[model samples]
Target chain A: MKAACVENGLVLVRELPDPEPGKGQALVRTHSCGLCASDAHFISGGQNVIDLSRKMGGPYAALHYERAFVPGHEFVGEVLDYGPDSRRSVKTGRRVTSVPIMRQGGTHAVVGFSHECPGGCGELMLLDEDFLLEIPEGLPDDHAAMIEPLAVGLEHARRGRPEKGDAALVLGCGAIGLGVIAGLAMMGVGPIVAADFYADRRDLALKAGAHIAIDPRETDPYGPLPDFGGRRVNLIYENVGVPGMLQRIVEAAPFDGRIVMGGYCMEQEALFVFAAQNKRLNIQFAGGEEPQDMDLALRSIADGRLDVTPWLGGRVGLGGVADAIANLSGPGTPVRTVVDPRLL
Target chain B: MKAACVENGLVLVRELPDPEPGKGQALVRTHSCGLCASDAHFISGGQNVIDLSRKMGGPYAALHYERAFVPGHEFVGEVLDYGPDSRRSVKTGRRVTSVPIMRQGGTHAVVGFSHECPGGCGELMLLDEDFLLEIPEGLPDDHAAMIEPLAVGLEHARRGRPEKGDAALVLGCGAIGLGVIAGLAMMGVGPIVAADFYADRRDLALKAGAHIAIDPRETDPYGPLPDFGGRRVNLIYENVGVPGMLQRIVEAAPFDGRIVMGGYCMEQEALFVFAAQNKRLNIQFAGGEEPQDMDLALRSIADGRLDVTPWLGGRVGLGGVADAIANLSGPGTPVRTVVDPRLL
Candidate 1:
């Protein structure tokens, strides 16, 4: 099996023995896998200290990711075979997208992020039955590959609980931000304002149903921008995790505003506690989506309410995973670059 | 009539003209009014910059309260007489607890906080019909005086949405914290752990139905403390709005914990956003409670589900308002020091 593994802080395409599924698991042949910014973070060793500390359970300091781990979670694959002692019958050749967690020793461990478990970045991977969700027959493989990131966006929007005709602001134009914009659009939340440093991503945000896009470098994020004739933003989706953004969001939110924080920032940041208190803000810190979010994402996309076609930049192979990770951070990077294991 | 007003940063009791209620208003004779920390904050000139900026609509800076503002909101009173042309059939001499807002020039203004509207710190006050809630017959005057703060606690706990048998933590043992403890007890959330620097407040918290109380000064708030044989805390009511408490709360919260911050801190605080993200915390910043919360609070007290008897200290006259404000900040402060306008 051909696999893309993080070996000693380097992303390498290595040939490895095929992994067999355990009881109540299925062997999935990778079809289409999307490259996430977190994958780049893991590959480039820029995982946030606090997130790493909690995920890996160590001291409150920078965490060094252990070497030799497969790194792709957002993927659509087909089940090739079920493992021995499997009780239920899930048909072979069923296309699916799944949560990246595998049950290990009565605990859940992320598939690709954990070195012990191989993920769908490889030619063949194991999927636990509990975490697997069948991709609908009508949904294409490319759109199915987006269920994970789209689910993340849906989860953030769900937590924000936007009402119809509520003003919203997306503070990042990355793939996740684009997904959030799409989700907000589906919910009929209008006058969506998106801000990003990059023009390309901002343009993509417009296609994802943002009513207005702003370059924060040119205009003050808190200062006067396109208001869409609304009083203030009701919900703020902060996807760019860095110091000072939360304060900026606090300055822009109206009274009783909801802020869904999905960004992954490495550094400790100062919060405007007094200001947030006066505004009576509800700042929810969100991470990955639950299984239901993924299912809803797929359903929304299949129903034509969500479109990920604009977000798909191009597809690559296992050999190109290294370049994809590097270029995704560069200027004028594509919104999303997927990988096909067969191309290796 | 007599009133205690903030005159040149001093709480002074002075004779004033008895107010004549206007259309749709009722003249209420004050009975029992509780002294809140916010009253102290207003009297002692500790308004935060954000609150000040929004209130005054100017640059971000600490706001100074103008002299001659009354300082009380938590109060129970009796409707002495109706204003001219008032259509309300509400019985005269009926005891009630009303919202602390007065309609002035077609806009509602906080009664005690606004210099133009006199509050319950006076012998008699004019009440707006829209803001009045009749007190049930069985409830005592002292407990009815607590309806406002108790409502705030109910609002925070309502936002937290704790299930039955969830481990909870209340970080402050002040009036608001004690109210949250009472609310949580009414909700049947158990093994409630409360922390405070003062032993008296801790004892009061235990009386308020806290299963356990810890002195954070002696024991590390983040380290191992008495857990009452329960798992990590699922909900944290943060009434102590200091710099490091948020980080400590993040460290102690279980995954997907809900933190309701009802504290009012004037200082700029640093929040561990990344740590909160890793824990997927739902942090809700609460302000004053709504009318529904107040209604629920009164019902809870009337049904004997909540008790504010431990929170009430000895009553004081209007002449002692200054001393109560000063001593409330001192060591060995009473749980709650209420004022009886008739005592003047």
Candidate 2:
């Protein structure tokens, strides 16, 4: 069992041969993983149009260029064995925290996310023992390998149903825009801000709370915007899919605004549609992330209303998965780094 | 008080001197008016870049050539007079309706749509009677000249929340795309279809309740769309604003779809961001009309939900405003027609 592969434009640390679980599955084993800038934009063809209508076993994009597979899908695995009639009772090993949105021989899903269909990192992940969750003996396996990017910044702040104290923004500081400004400052929202043409992802989006951190190549993301005091963000979340970030978040929204998006840019460029129709904008996009946003994000990380430890920077070992893809293909690295896969 | 003036592109009727009401205002008097294609797209410059975000209004982009100014704004008037403490009142000749959203005495409220904002219309229409809406007396000045495209298809089916039986699609068969299939068939939505490239606006959108029209100059509006009875169109609406109809309503949506957009087109298009991120579209855009969507569209046309009499056809005064703007400027003029600005 060794794994960590990619091959051709290289990554490899391979081995293989290990299979087991069947009826309803549950094999698992990793215990740590998370690299995402969408796995360095799908190994750098800048997100080569994925959406194989959910094909499971393959180094997708037509055999990840003629073979070599395994890359990682955000994890914290454990199980080790299950199978037969499985209504879910993983036992051979226990201590879980999975999701790699399975398909490569099934289970431990949560890769790109799911409503009920995917997850399970690498080094073997056959989950379906009800998509395993278990991990709470006082949370820590590096915070369950950071609950899949804080469940993708709690599914992009649960699409602007934000209230209790609103104000947010977070354009693109990577790792899901600093996990959506640490899940909109743990759902209470605040001066948030975050943008990023990159000043080290705006100093790690001001240690993940972001009370300000601009730099759209230093100012002028269509002027103004960056305030916070007299709050005027009512949520924007867009993780830079850069089509001029949909006309700069509809010219930095506010008047009845919402946005959401969640990066993966390709281009269609501008769209003001009269400033998203005179600021009566809603613009949603990041859909599908259920289990009720991971059970209200593990009850907002056990009631501290989330913290995602300032986007935790370093943690390697899957034989440094090719030095975590050359420190996440440098743009000044450091955004969300974490991976163990039992140290390859 | 005469009016009818597009100058140089001719259509004269001149005179002038009447406009009174001031301070919060109210003068009204037009009584029935509807000649929009945004006034033949501002006498055919086709809403010239909404004259730079003024959401269209003004005598612009060259041609006004000397003596011109008095374009219409979609009327159905009456109040007849008021000036003091005027914040609106159902007095002196009552029956009202005005949305002429225009401001910028951008050179004397260019006459029609009774300039609701600018010096707010003249030869008399000072109205801000906090945006008037009383049209009731047995509804028919051709259904109060369809309260401005039925309050813009009731604000595009209330910003396309469309559900109670959705199967909409209504692209564009003029008169604001069959008044958005008569307000998505008064919200009981059904097999509505109605594409149009014009065979008399697809026979006036199959006489308005359009259960299928198509025609896109014979077909293929990015194919696949036709069937509404095996269910498809979970709402399209677009109202033909020309520049690639928001990329053919995102290559014909359906997978969590809803387009809406009211249309006016000018160049600024390209939107497929991964097929609107795997068909999760919402898109919306009405562009104007929101006084509680003309008071729930005059209480859904005084509660019978709505009926534009098979998209009316003819009825004029003010001396058939230049042969009703040359028979509603070509191809199929029977989609809607109304004018009696008190016969000028």
Candidates in order, TM-scores: namely 0.73, 0.38
DockQ, 0 to 1 scale, candidate 2: 0.10
Q: First chain TM-score in every candidate?
A: 0.87, 0.34
Candidate 2 per-residue lDDT, tens place, B72-160, comes to 66666677777777645677687777565433334423235223332211234555566677877788766776766777766776677
- Best by the TM-score measure: 1
DockQ of each: 0.35, 0.10
Q: Write the per-residue lDDT of candidate 1 for residues B1-344, one digit (tens) a residue.
A: 89887775788999988888888888889998888877765444345552646653422232245547666888889999988888665688899887776775644666666655577788888888777899988788888998888887877777677897568888888878888888788788887888898888889889888988888778644343455542556788998755676766776677788888887665667765767776788888876688888888888778777767877776899998888887775457776788988897
Deviation of model 1 at A84, angstroms: 8.2
Per-residue lDDT over A1-344 for candidate 1, one digit per residue giving the tens place of the 0 to 100 score: 89988765688999888888888888899998888877765544445552546653533222236556677888889989888888535578989888777776645667767655677688888888877898889787878988898888888877788887567889998878988898888788987888898888888889889988889778644443445553455788998766788877776677788899988665667765666776688888986788988888888778877677877877899999988877775566777889989897
Judged by lDDT against the true structure, how good is candidate 2?
Answer: 0.62
DockQ of candidate 1? 0.35
CAPRI band for model 2: incorrect
